[model samples]
Target chain A: MTISTTPVPEPVVADRPPEPVRRPARHARLREWWLGAALVLPALALAVAFKLVPLGRGVATSLESSSGFDGTSFAGADNYVRMFDDPVVRSSFRNALLVVATLPVWVVLPLVLAVLIHQQAPGWKFFRAVYFIPYTVAPIVVGIMFRQILAPDGPINALLRRVGLEPLAIEWLNGRYSALFSLVAVALWSFFGLGVMTYLAGLATIPGETLEAAYLDGAGFWRRLFHVVVPMLRPTVAYWSVLCASGVLIWLFPLIYALTQGGPGDATMLPEYLVFLTTFQFLDRGYGSAIGIALFVFVAVLSIFSVRHMFTEGTRKPR
Target chain B: MNRRTAARLGRYLLTFALVVVAVAAVYPLLFTVVSSLKTQAGFAEDPLGLPAGITLDNYLEAFRRMDMPRLLLNSLITTVGGLVLSVLAALLVAYAVTKLRFRGGKLVFLLIIVTLTIPSQAIIYPLYQTVLDLGMSGEYQGLILAYAAFGLPLGTYQLAGYFQQVPDELIEAARVDGAGHFTILFRLLAPIATPALAALAIFNFVWMWNDLLLPLVIMGGSDSKTLMVGVSLLSGQYDVSVPLVSAGLIVALLPVLVIYLVFQRQLVSGALAGSGK
Candidate 1:
């Protein structure tokens, strides 16, 4: 399958007739196979030892009960059952759902910005460069910075007070809904730059004549955006949507850790964060593994489309 | 309004909104840098105000309290080590799968790409146990290996795509000259693959440096904490000075900020490569 996909060099095919050199070619091919295996062995070993092996063990660990310094014993599905009744686990998944529900905003906001920038909006270059600055800062740093900024007596509230919005100057990270909202907003802020970059790459694949035709036909910006640009960007949009959806579950650990630590009354608890707390902090390896496995399953279901898309996309011949 | 005038107004509003978002994006970091230089008392009196008197006390204190040098060293070692290992693995695997075209190359490529969907969180605990079982817990190699393992998928995916573009004739020519795969890969293809490798390196560097989870979990209360872990711990401390924490945040952010400024193009392109179809 792999050999058929890649075109053999034309000169080799042209210069060397098939039957005459078949014997030496077979020898060379065997050598090539060995060389490929040798090159790939170390990486394959690392992946298996670290990733594949642990993945299976992680599932196994999830099914067992262990506590304190005691050795493990099989608990069957007790941990999974307990997860359903655990308020923290329940809310963590609930918050994860809430964050995932914000996927449209995550996808569309950067996309719109990318479109505007793609149109060469005034200062687009500067906007392109400056907008990515937040993404460069580590999420933990972003979280820590915002923790102070969102403190009740912090700059955000102070500015609100200065602007005569005293009532609106409430605790940003201390309230239930507000903390979750703040997290979503902050995560979006830190990530939208990459979204924009992705969309721009997608946009670059689009030919100019199509947009030019739309312009010449008197389509306005919004019309051109929705009509001409967006349809062409479905793959990119799907890509980002899948990325953000999974990201909301997996990638927000640092932000949650630094900003709210699953926050004011479990408002910001995510399953991934809860897994960390449960496994590392609370020492409930069985339950934490359960949550981890559950999160992994959810992410896998969500990622199937994108994974397939990316697989074909990655292997597709470069244009 | 006339269509032309309305279009002009829309353009103005669009630019204005873009500027506003740009400021929103950059303002927090500027706020942190400025506030880091302010006296604590000054910060308390007016948290939003520009500093009354610039002071380096917070930075100095942060450096001392956070053991800045040690954290920096730990972060440098892991980031560089992870970057080198992952990029090399990706480069070699990409070359093998793309150029070598041996049997099962497709399966090897597929296995690596599929791992992209597996989030580190899912495997965190077991991965931790594996590291501990190997007796590499709290060691540099443990975290480095984990980073390299996670990083391999994306790097290989991107580099394989890049490698596919290199015509087969190049490798064939080298082979005819009596070059083996290793020599051709390192001496020949590696240079050709430099742009892709550099972009992958920058991308992985930023991620591995900024990452807190692997280091935090694997290092596990060890003194050899990465800078992000150190900053996180600093924030977690009770009665922590906001300014001091701000300084620590800046300290953690400085390397990434410098990398961003210097390799802005590569960084942006790397991001593009990450998501590019």
Candidate 2:
């Protein structure tokens, strides 16, 4: 390797790659592997220490009974047995199933709104700005505000009464299933902006000529949404769904804690909240770990789907 | 009616409906702002209407009653520290993952993504235990590392996307020029990835600032709680006093509101950047 012979300075192609040779030396290839491992070591070390170990430890702790972090007895499957038998915990799992069922409403509304905004609907700028505000606001703050708004005689119900529909004004918080639905609605409201933003990004990648061509074929907005826009947007939707499913499992803790307390008969009790309650409130670390493991599995499963395509080189476009 | 006229009318109606939904989205926050200005009596008198009276007392109380300065400082340290840690680490490794194609490049990237699937709740206990074992619990370094660990996947993922744009010639040039990975990353790549770095910083900072659980549990109702967790605890004490709670909510929200106002476009673009694929 003669250092002096190779061109010392090329102004333009200095930043551009010279054509690759068919082969590289073995030592050079070995150096690349060491460099790569060294580069990734910091992030990898942190993940292993903070995330991976705890994940394994959490599973370990779930199998062992603990009284305030000091533990002795190996309670093999007792926590799981207790969790399944306990009616409140059972209902919490059921509530999770119900929440998961609402994934369509969560995904579709934002996709539709994003497409409308992409089409340049009236006041779309204002709509986009307004819609995104909630995403930035802390969930706890939103929870506190919604607690008031959804109080038995709160503004929503107040409006219902004023509109001559008194029968429709059910108890928003304290009723049997009202708080559950209220939780779902608030989650929906806060998160759809995320979907809208993502889909809008997806929409940008799409050539306008595609939509224009569809329009030329006598396709209206509805037809285009299904045939043209949707197929292009599926990847984004998949990513958002996985992100959101994990969110539903874990992110609802603050809102549930602040707004509903998983009350009115465990209707709104998500597994995360159940874990929180078990660990902190009741000092049942064993049971909480069990619930947390279940929630972790659920999230891990959903995340697998999204991460597959999300990081591929094909996703990148040259500037 | 003619077909064209009807289509335009329908479009207008859809726009009108969208506007209504937007109003619904922002109304609670707007209501909190308006309600914060009222006397407790005034708010109770007309919960749905504009305040009949105005005073800055609640805001004053909101500031004075809580340890806002300490909490704010704690928040700044944790969030900014987390942002730097996550970005620097992510940027270093992202360069490798994107450009190095070293042994197990795919495996490394996949491992990072797998971290995303681990529910923070599941790991919260052991993460908490790890911090305690180090005795760094409640300190900025502890919380910052925890936050960085939590945020690494998304940070690395997004930064790597931007990292892919670095031309091979530049990386090769640096290598040929005797620059190691750190030199290549910090002096060379870091400056070029400023836009992505800024986005990651703002995004991570806001997230750490807004998070309540970590501060609440790890900080453990001590002097070290972040501003968000402080406000959460503070509002509980205010209880039924809508004026005070609203005032507190407004206080907690102010910084993010300012950031949003100034960097709205960047934030939106940064958030949506990943979904483009």
Candidate 3:
């Protein structure tokens, strides 16, 4: 290889370089700042004004119990103390834990369902769409539909009558043991699509060659899925599980409101519903705000942990 | 048998199972529509079957009792207003995060991500008070703002992904051509991002349209209530009219059903693909 260079002489213009230096005009700088500010301002304003400010107010509100409009009187941390002491509140807490335990079934079933549909077996797209279609419908609509279907003259009763298993068709959402299960069923129906979608994306990243290699090594389907596919999809599983858990807690609003209305003797009164009752129904803004703060802190902590896990795992695998 | 042949057979079976599932999914809708057309006597006689004698009385009763037209209009205004605000604000934030280099860009993005963790219920009470304090309670603007707050994070995340896919060279060329940031965003990026924008719009449209809580609180007055609220109120203890409620639900759900059928693929793709992150 040969390299050649020409020596340059700077005798012509000793004061400056030959190329002109073009500084960004004032308008461009102004525009850059304006654009940047414009982009950051709306979201910032929304977050602070809507989220942060309200959160602060909620904390302050929790200290006061107003009997009339704008007649709040501070009671220190009595609301928090009351929250711990109240039997209904204690039961609500216990009920929430029970619901949380069932969260795993909703989380894992969706992942398993997603994997079932993501497989290259056949008609996967059709199955995927079929499962996902329910997610598009509003929770209100599902609530209304289930209300009818679980009613005495609904299809389930008719089906059971025909099968001579009439006792099996009982009041679903109105019964104590069955109401929570019904709500869970609805949640699974609505959100399993999201899980399926998430898992499909994870499956997309697993190269076909990897699966083929496993098959060639005489590994069976369940063995490959448990050993290879599950390991590769850990990040996705973690992300979805966290997301689904938080979503179950937050998005249970519509389902609870529509189906049970926290009914069958308050068997399904979630924290969100309780917050509503406290604030509006009972006119206890302070206590409602306290519950709101608690719910926010709970969701925030879970999400932070999950997102942290995602990043750590994601970094290790270069995802 | 060959693997291909076996796969083909499996596909057939899977498709058949899907058909059955789809039918099951749509059955409630069919029942609603059918029962709406039936007379009260006919419905009571055969609640699970087709009505022997059909009538539009349920629709008329539902419309008259629920004030369907006004409720529909209220829903439309709130959804449109909420969608416009959410999409614009989200796009602006998304554009900034994806394109501009700034010190707090990542922080702003992280803030949006964290906002998703803050459920609307968490802030409902304070938000209600804030709305009252602003003197905008029971107003469309308050409802729209609430919906926008809920929808902003998802919209920004989705739009950011869409914006990131546009080639850097295209943006660079536009910059060199003396196009300002606004011009590039409105003229160049807007057209390219239309499909994604449409998908987001549809998602927000359904969300805001079908939402029962914010409007239930902010717009609880008779003149201001949304479809969800109206339908819910109609189903209250005094007048537990199943047929009337079903009719109202169908009316409330028709627009969403139409949008879903028309853009099912895009909505599913955007939702699934976005969550893949």
Sliding window of 10 residues with minimal summed lDDT for model 3 chain B: B233-242
- Model 2 RMSD, rounded to 1 decimal: 3.3
Q: Show where candidate 2 strays beyond 4 Å.
A: A1-32, A68-70, A215-220, A311-319, B173-183, B271-277
- The lDDT of model 2 is 0.79
On lDDT, the leading prediction is 1
Alpha-carbon error at B229 in model 1, in Å? 0.8
Candidate 1 CAPRI level: medium
Best of the two (1, 2) by DockQ: 2
lDDT of 1 by residue, B76-159 (tens): 998898888888888878888888858998899888877776788988989988999999999999999989999998888877
Q: Which candidate is the best by DockQ?
A: 2
Candidate 1: which stretches are off by over 4 Å? A1-24, A215-217, B269-277
DockQ of each: 0.50, 0.51, 0.32
Q: Candidate 2, residues B89-202: lDDT per residue as tens digits?
A: 888778888887587776787788679888677667767888888898877788988888888988888777776776767777666656666666766677767666767787
lDDT of 1 by residue, A1-319 (tens): 1222222233233354233312347777898798899878877877887888888998899899997679999999999999889999889989999998999899889988998887789989899988878888899999989988888888788889989999999888889899999999999999999899888878776777875576446666677777877888888888889989988998899999988899898999999899999998899898888899999899988887776875676577656
Instruction: Tell me the alpha-carbon RMSD of every candidate.
Output: 4.0, 3.3, 7.7
Query: How do the predictions measure up, each by TM-score?
Result: 0.93, 0.93, 0.87
